[model samples]
Target: MMFEENPPSSYLTRAAHSEDSQETITAISHVLRDQEDTQLVPADDSESFAAPGDLPANPTSPQQRLAKLKLLMTQQKAEYESKIARLEQRNRELQWEIRDTQWQLGQQRQRHRLAEMKIRNAERAKEDAERRNEMLQKEMEEFFETFGEINGWK
Candidate 1:
């Protein structure tokens, strides 16, 4: 389901401020740090190197710094792409779970309907048996009375 169609406000707020989101941000920062540390930049290429806590004052060579920026952007792009892929896979899993729950609900409803039908049938059978028993009891009483009358015992 698309979240934008009928998104819950609480869900959006929770997602934005979630621990997982914060961890992902922290991980991306670490990745950027690691990449920067691993790259070997020559000391003579001072145009691309920015001093710690100091902004690059030289605007003479923009191309070198532009190349470094492009590289960093590419790495971050890859990290974000992988994260998106994982989130998509999780979405699919959740959809399947919802479908399974719905199927179980349908099956339970069918069983409940069947149970109700059986109960009604049982009630009808009980009523029929009680009626027959009353008819048989009346006939027995009449037979005993007739026999008693013919034998002159009454």
Candidate 2:
């Protein structure tokens, strides 16, 4: 007997005896009847279903597309975070450099002020030494004149 498109005669006869063949035939008939009674209902026209061609044409299902987009976003976010971290590190280095530069400038200015003070002090000392030398020269010249006058009287 035929069950759906398959003939049960071949499977039933393959068994050892007539009783076994009858039992096999009965089981196959029951399965076929159950399948026929519980037929799968088709989807409505408004409802969308994934066709076999759809996945190959689109290259991604809706869930897979969302996951891919999320992955790309996460990668971009990580890159941006790394860039920001690098920039922050560079900014800190620049701040340190600026502080060092300012310290150098202050030290140079201090040295310049000290040099100017030393120059002013040297100028004052030179002026005082010149005044003392002029006074000593005048005193020596007067003593020589008095001594010459005294010697002439002899």
For this target, which candidate reaches the highest TM-score against the unseen true structure?
2
The residue-by-residue lDDT of candidate 1 on 1-154, one tens digit each, is 0112212222222322333554434444543443255332223433234333343445322433444454455557667878999999999999999999999999999999999999999999999999999999999999999988988964
Which residue pairs in candidate 2 have backbone atoms (N, alpha carbon, C) closer than 3 angstroms, thus clashing? none
RMSD of 1: 15.4
Which pairs of residues clash in candidate 1, taking residues 3 or more apart in a chain or in different chains?
A: none
Per-candidate RMSD vs. true structure? 15.4, 22.1
Candidate 1: minimum summed lDDT over ten consecutive residues — where? 1-10
lDDT of each: 0.56, 0.57
lDDT score for residue 91 of model 1: 98
Q: What is the lDDT of residue 12 in candidate 2?
A: 28
State TM-scores per candidate: 0.57, 0.60
